[model samples]
Target: MARMRWSTSHTRPYTLRQRRRGRERIQALEQQVAELRAQLATQWVQAQPTPGTRLDTLLTLCSALLVTHDLPAILQLVVQQAKALFVGASGVLLFLSDTTGQMLELRATSAGTLPPMRVYPGQSTAGRAFLAPRAMLMAGPELALALDEQQPAQYAELSNLLTHWPPVSALLAPLRLESQRLGSLVIYGGSRAQPFVPRDLPFVQALADMVAIAIVDVEERNRTTQLASQLTQTQTNYAEIQARLDTAQAQLLQSAKLAAVGELAASVAHEINNPLYAARNSLYVVEQDLAADAPERAFIAVAQAELGRIARIITRMRDFYRPTRTELEPTCLNEVLRATIELVHTHLRHGHVTIQHELDAQLPQIVAHADQLRQVFLNLMLNACDAMPTGGVLTIRSTNEPGDASAASIVAIQISDTGSGIDPEHLPHIFEPFYTTKAQGTGLGLAISAHIINQHGGCIAVASTLGQGSTFTIHLPFTPPPTVVLSMYSTLS
Candidate 1:
């Protein structure tokens, strides 16, 4: 009995020791399970992007769309952000080509440099996604089948492009805004620790929407800019056309006025000439009849001189209507100018005016009427003297212009006076017949000068500044036009 009791006591203590060890093992196992649960939670949280992070990514893309206009730059930004959004994934952006809407061109990629690639609708993954209504997650056999259906040439090109970073799986989202389908955004998964799944579609689709909006905005802006430029050019053209019409109307009016004045002057001069000659002859006879020492002799002489002056005035009026028949010759312009200056030197000096000559030494002689040119020069110089009554400088300049493709070589003469400039309102009418600013002026000088220049197939222009000075420029060709010369001869004959 004593032996049985000792065995029972020893076995019970050993059983208690084993039970304690088993309880300790259960506690250790519980701790291991808790640690495993914590690790799983951490992995799950890391696998999915946080709501705040996704929103920030979308906002950043929206900001890029608003500010940036360059298509490639925006595409690159989209692909980069897409790659960052999907862990262990590369990205590609494809768009319909501007030249061919049927083909999709690879624009940007996160996978470094690749050869140019194009895909046809319904023939490749990107193209199919463009036609699809929603995003697609393709993998394994589906991706291979899509590639195998492509034309051999396209397959080779796409294969070459994909070799840089071959995709194990692909997530595609069509870039669409309402009814408009632009292209596709593709996220390619290689040998990634976390593979793409169906849940990733919404994020990629949102990004694709951003890309579409950006493209549409940029294209619309470019179109608006081009239209504005065209509008401005059209307005400028309209203004130029209007100005040309105004100038043509003014020239037509002037030509009509001159024709009417010429007819009237010719009639009046013809009527006066016969009576003028009779009066002059009668006065001369009376002067001859008077005795040399007679008191009436001096008065008779004065009457003869006054009748002669009247005849001269009538002759000038006739000449203005029908220019004197003068043949065009190779006239030395310098000689004509020098003689005219000599005749007007005392007149200009009396008005306290100084004359300056800036003649070209190598000036070529032109075909012109020397006498008519002398008349024009004398008239212009006298007018300049009249303008500068209180002393000023009169500058006469002559230059020989070289020929060009559009125009022949020509001679340019400028007569400038530092005097009270012409009133802007009067400048347009200064060359009109019987128009005069001076109180006692005959007003035929400038009109005759302009007519003679026009008959020679040349042009005269005047520029003046208020309170400054005036310059009169004459442009004469080296040779007069055959038509103009023939017309002049016909008129004289």
Candidate 2:
């Protein structure tokens, strides 16, 4: 009995230990089973279609839409893809007309015998879809009933148009980008067995959203291109207008300066005339009193000549402000040019300047004051000679510019010199009186030349490059009108 009792105690402990180990093994097996169950559940969920798959599809559709730029192509692609998403389905896309916002026009269709239809807002099924905020799914009977109740004429028209390929059900979604309601997209099912379900609404709506995005993007890009073109044109016009304004302002300022200088010159000439006359008379008397053979008599003669020259200069100054009417006659400009050149031939020779003439042989005669024209030519020639201090070619050209319907014939004379050119900063003021770059200049040569040309109803212009050369161009009409001559004489007198 003792040995049996001892054996029972030991067997009981071993059995208890075995039970604990078996229980632990069962618990471990249960844990493994739970883990396996969790893994299977995850795999099953992964295998099924989820929102992420839809998102990836939407992203792919968006990428496709973004690469396309044409509006019609984009709409056609959308409808075709939507139709492809469901079997036995036809798709149509409608958009608001750009010209008339009140009407929605059929833009693209995948498969249908429907005519090109224009629908008014709040009138048809597509219109209602466009006005709605979210997507809608309607059975074919319900759609027809609503169409008949809302618009009988439209329902009859649609029935006639769709008799060949009638719709059994439809999924509609509004094309909207933010607050802008662009249009609507509709997918029509032909078989009742393959009717679009509620789950199809989100996908159709996504396509509609893509259409809206594509349309808005294309339109915005077009508008941006137009605005950029307009901006460039506006800038060009502004620059041209500003340049004209600057020219006008400079002309006005020049006129003001000339008027002020004329008044001052008249006053100074009046003040100096009396003293100059007295000195000339006294010198003449001294010359008459001295003996002809006396050395002092030669000095008196020179004094009289100097006084006479000063008087002539003073007279020219007076004529500048208050010119007398010099009689006009038929004058040959070519002849006048020859005479003036002869007078300055010595000076030009001493300056080592070579003169080249390109006179027009058939040049016609114009009515002008020969002496005044000669003086202008002389001044210009002398100035040209002075420009070429070291020696350069002086080219004189004369051409007769024929008249057009708007302009009369004129004579154009160009005098060009290969000499140091005028500085750009000094070119604008060169014609103003008392403006000169030479130390010994009287500063009245160009100013008087401009005035003389103005009185003759002509114009003079100069073009110079700082390092290249200079050209002075004079344009004279074939004849000044009688009224212009008379007006000029009257104003100057």
Query: After aligning candidate 2 to the native by TM-score, how far in Å is the CA of 160 from where it should be?
Result: 7.8
What C-alpha lDDT, on a 0 to 100 scale, does residue 447 get in candidate 1? 89
Which parts of model 2 have CA positions greater than 4 angstroms off? 1-60, 97-102, 111-116, 149-164, 275-324, 402-407, 423-429, 432-435, 439-444, 465-468, 481-483, 491-493
lDDT of 1 at 224: 90
Candidate 2, residues 359-463, lDDT tens digits: the string is: 899888887767667777888888888888998888888888889999999998888888888999989888887789999996778888887777778998999
Cα error, residue 17 of model 2, in Å, equals 62
User: Which candidate achieves the best lDDT against the true structure?
Assistant: 1
* Residue pairs in collision within model 2: none
